[model samples]
Target chain A: MLKIEGVSKLFNPGTVDEKIALLNANLHMKQGDFVTVIGSNGAGKSTLMNIISGVMKPDAGNIYIEGTEVSQLSEYSRSKWIGRVFQDPMAGTAPRMTIEENLAIAYKRGKPRGFSFGVNSKNRKVFREELSRLGIGLENRMTAKVGLLSGGERQALSLLMATFTRPQILLLDEHTAALDPARAELVTTLTENIVRELNLTTLMVTHNMEQAIRLGNRLIMMDKGKIILQVDEAQKQGLTVERLLGEFERISGKKMADDRVVLG
Target chain B: MLVSLVGAVELGLLYALMALGVYITFRILDFPDLTVDGSFTTGAAIGTVMTIAGSPPWLAVIFAFFGGAVAGTLTGLLHTKGKVNGLLSGIIMMIALYSINLRILGKPNVPLRGEANIFDGASVLTIGLILAVVAKIGLDLFFKTNLGLSLRATGDNSRMIRSFGANTDGTIIMGVALSNALVACSGALIAHSQNAANNSMGIGMIVIGLASVIIGEAIFGAKTIFRATLAVVLGAIIYRVIYALALRVEWLDAQDMKLITAVIIVGALVIPTIRRAIKSKSIAKKRTEEVLSSMGQTSGGGS
Candidate 1:
């Protein structure tokens, strides 16, 4: 459902402190393919997602969602087809807005947003029912500001919001990196459940190797902006964290030095 | 004293519009938009000029709103597409607007001789109060809308807003437009009320708007959306009353009006910080006491 061809990204071009983020990276995903991307710090995992989301433009690349070239689209324009959840739980939701209000924005995604009266009773009921599905009792607190929610609750709400309109592609950028272990597991489970239910073509960038193995149907490892190894359905079914790291070392010619990634 | 109080209320009503604008930019969008400095005068200049051109009063006010929106859009473009800092964009626009405002007015000031004002043919205080209520309710309802939710979300967390397939740039543009439109409307009303629009009138207008927002947030405790907006309106009136009353004081120097306004803003902003510090200290003290008491009990049991 999504195709990325020869994507190259360079930060601070022609400056003294310049770095090439992505170098000739290519990715292709089928419909309902949940691809988990694992990479170290500065591995261009987030950059790849950002490019797809239109947060940052690739220096040279052609990105197609359902065969439409979106590399040149602005973040606002690209947003119509892309849904994203960030590493920071606070990044994906407005703190001051109530649950219902945030959901309203999500519901009206890609639609013309002009002046209107207010959230009427009919919309309120729909919002309440939507919130109830999370099993967090958020439906009862529709009027509560999102700031009042805990990290897990907020992330769950964010995931729901990102997939509310069922975009062509969902980009998860370390979405559960900020939560506690128990909360992270809960949110991860929720993520798996939502992706499965919607059958969304998703790119989930994660540092947790275990989650990379456990959650998605396909797993890809990246080093220095290039895809080092990718596992398909048959191989991915029996993949382990240790074998993944072994493959990483063999392909990249370097051991994963980042303790956070190893420990995580 | 009563006359000054009434005049303060009138000023406060006009200021509520600017305060609302500031609330949107500084608080809601988390964008420090300085365009108000120029847009306020731009609105006044354009509205006063339109009135001079024999335009209908209501239409002149509407025109001023659109004028402010145009200026805001320029700032938005500079920030979004041009990747300019919001503050710098606003400042650049403000500088450019000063000249544009002058050109529109054709001079430093333009008098609205016999045109209808917001308070025209009505008791100034009565009309002012009514306008304040209308603006407050009108905006409260708007903020609850889908578009308004997106605007507020644009400031609170832009990433989430974008993920929803909403254009953050479009929201920013709409937000800036909405903010400056309110400010411009204020300028329009003020110009008509005072019967003249002066080039220097918008100086310190942003500070006043900030002061009102700060003061309102402090006084209103920012607990509810309705209360917060209402507090801002109240803060503007209160600030004006205090300013007017200070001017009437025999011992207070009238030249220090700006200084007094500055002090009020500083005081309002600092209150929250001070409260937070005091609360933290008290909590620390209580924790320390509990730890000491626990140690003492353990030693006593050991003995």
Candidate 2:
């Protein structure tokens, strides 16, 4: 379970380009809860994830995961408990490393990394089993360079790498946006299956309203750095795109003009 | 011709050290550290001066390494604390080092005669080559340490590195310091080996270092950190041998040396991409076969 209370982040606070990215944003998720977040451009969706991942500290807020306050912890320290996949497929993993090496780094997320000996039989077996479950036939190509993987394969591999250590929270920031539609679907389905199988708490940020509606048990809509719409399982399940847009218009007093959201 | 070949081998051993330094900053850390140009001169100047002042050759080399490391640390500090771009930081440090190097020797060049080096009247090439191998082994082992991991991770992803509770600034400092230290050490050895050190000798040194790294990566393949470093060392020696071979041709002259080095680097960068293209072509073939097999199974079952 995770709790974020009164978390506000301001970028370039006193500068000419000062923008309040997150204005008293608050989010709470129960254990094993999957939450989907939708927002237009500059909605602070990525900023919220960055706050949780410790990429950026909130200007004013407190974050608690399983009752442990982690707002003060650095990104690396928080990384042990937090797994994340970035929007750019190239950003999530090091390209030059082999599939197993990338997984090895992920596996040792917080642990001290050491000299390369041959990856032992036990570790190899574990990696193989984990890769096999993805059903992507990556187990055989453990030595293959991750750079060679297609966008979809890499994203899936990255997702697996992110969850390999079973972090306390998984953050997916437009993880499949770069992939082709078919590959995106494959990765998203894979994402749902993995989250369910692990019963992991997850926060997925998306531009697609349909994906935002269908994937997670909870749906939250945001605009101008504030969460204007929050829906639970019953409310979210009963919702459609039109109703969500109406709720957004009513709460934020602005029409959602982003074509990404409208067409998606 | 034999004397020239042997001389090239000796120079190659010394150059390997320079390449090692380049590998640390440029290859492993992915930093375009130009401190190498200044640090190399700083090392040679310090070593030559110290040797002329009746210091032991080994001690002089150590002092040179210290000088280079200090210069490297300055560059790292400028980049990390002062928030200077890596290339600019190196350039600034290198420019400052020119004056500092001149001050260290109190002259443009220093000449050494009857000095005690790590090698004596025997085959200097063999002795230097052995030393290069030992240094490479030692560096490979060093990179396996916790601090080394942090340094490497800093190069890989600074954000990811910072989140791990390690200070990226400290890691950069250590990496730059270590890289320049090695380069300066190489300069010291070169000064002693050649019996003279000139302040301007460091010019074009970074190019050679980069050439060695590229050549090594091309020949040995960069499978792991250890192999990568080792390849860099070997590449330095091989690069020298190749250069020596080129100069041995009756048609080539020392004046065209820079042109040859440039050609070598171009070759190093290209070979890897060519290999990748070939490998990917094969992978594509296998992929099509895999798709066909899977498709056949799925269609047969569904039909």
Candidate 3:
């Protein structure tokens, strides 16, 4: 469903504070592949996601989504095939907009927006039904400003929005990291349910090792701008946190130092 | 007093158009566009010049809107394409418009003492009311459209909207252009009603427009776009009424209007913060009472 070839990105090149974000990164995913990504801080995980989403162009790379090369497309253009949920709860939705209005925008994704009214009675009914599916009673608050929603509710709404138009790829960048444990669990469950039901090709970047291991068909570990380890379905079926840590130590020759990863 | 009130309402309605324009850029787009200060003059100058050249008053006003829209587009280009700072781009346009407005008029001012204007046959208040209502209704409808929602979303969160496949840069440009068009239309109407267009007439227009928007939102609330626009119009009228009343003071000169406008804007801006502070303070007091009462109840139960 997605392909990345020879991708490289350098931040502040030629500057004293230069850092290599991505280096010759290569990744591929089959249609409907649910892949979970795990890495420490500065592991180029976000850079990889950003490159795929066209938020920033790789210095040298070709990105193809559903067999179409979109490396040269602008972020908004590339968004036609990509749905993204950001790390910040506040980043995924417009705070001042209402639930139905937000859904209307998501519904128009990858489609031409013209003089037609964004939300009519018909769409409002659809949105209410969809919101009701989340089981959060958000259908009653279709006109409530999204800003008034809790972090968990907003993230869940964002998940619904990302899948509303059924993009070629869905990118989740620590989407539930800001929420409390219970809320995080709710969002994670919602994410799994939505992806599974739609059979969406999804790439979820997570700091939680258990989440990375427990969800998704495959798991990949990234470090120092490269995918250092990948666990296929066979290996992932028996994967454990201690074994993964041992594998990381054996491969990278360094202890897993990220506290969040360790705690998870 | 009655005549002053009537005049205030008339002028208020005229300025309400400009206030709505200001609301688009300031509140909707989250863009601090100073272009209105210049575009207002540009519209007035164009309208007067076109009218002097024997064009119909309505056509002249329409031309004025387009003229201002073009200026606004330039500002948008400077900010978006040229990668200039938004504030700096607006300032550049405002400075450039001074020369453009002077050239258009061929002088510092143009008097329409005997020329045909839209208000020549109609009462100024009636025409102003009609224009204001039309602009409000048009804006309310536009905001309900898909493009309009995208525009509002762009203002609310550019990155988020862009990820939804909306062209944010284009939306910003269109928004800024539309806003200035409205401002220019207001200026054209004012020029016709006042019987003259002066180069200096646009000075401090941004402040007045902002004042109207802030005052309107504070008093009328902005739960919806329609209500927000209505608030802006009412705010403009109230501002004009206050101006007229202030002029009635023996010590205040007509020239002090600008200072009074600044003061009104400051008051409007501060009112919200004051309200918030008072609300928080009352909440804190209520919490203290609750805590003390709970402690007293627990102590009494133990005793």
Q: Write the per-residue lDDT of candidate 3 for residues B1-303, one digit (tens) a residue.
A: 999899999999999999999999999999999999999999999999999999999999999999999999999999989999999999999999999999999999799989999898889999999999999999999998899999999999999999999988899999999999999999999999899999999999999999999999999999989899999999999999999999999999899999999899889889899999999999999999999999999999999
- Every model's DockQ: 0.68, 0.22, 0.88
Quote the chain B TM-score of every prediction: 0.93, 0.92, 0.97
Q: Judged by TM-score, which candidate is best?
A: 3
Give the CA lDDT, 0 to 100, for residue A147 in model 1: 95
Q: Is candidate 1 or candidate 2 better by DockQ?
A: 1
lDDT, candidate 2, B85-130, per-residue tens: 9999999999999999888878886787676665565567776777
DockQ of 1: 0.68
Model 1: pairs clashing at backbone N, Cα or C within 3 Å: B29-B155
- Candidate 1 lDDT over residue span B234-254, tens digit each: 889899998988887888887
Which wins on lDDT, candidate 1 or candidate 3?
Answer: 3
TM-score of 2: 0.83
Residues A1-264 of candidate 3: C-alpha lDDT, one tens digit per residue: 899999999999999989999988888999898999988788999999999998999899899888899998999999999999998989989899899989999999978889999999999988988898898889999999999999999999999998967898999999988899999999999999999988999999998988899999999988889889989888899999889888989998998777666346
True contacts kept of each: 0.86, 0.24, 0.82
lDDT of each: 0.86, 0.84, 0.93
Summarize candidate 2's per-residue lDDT along A1-264 as a digit string, tens digits.
789999999999899999989999899999898999987789999999999988899889899988999998878778878888888887776676667766666667777655553255667789999999888889999989788998888888889988878888999998888888999998999999999989889999988888888898999888888887789998886888888888888887888867666345
Q: Is candidate 1 or candidate 2 better by lDDT?
A: 1
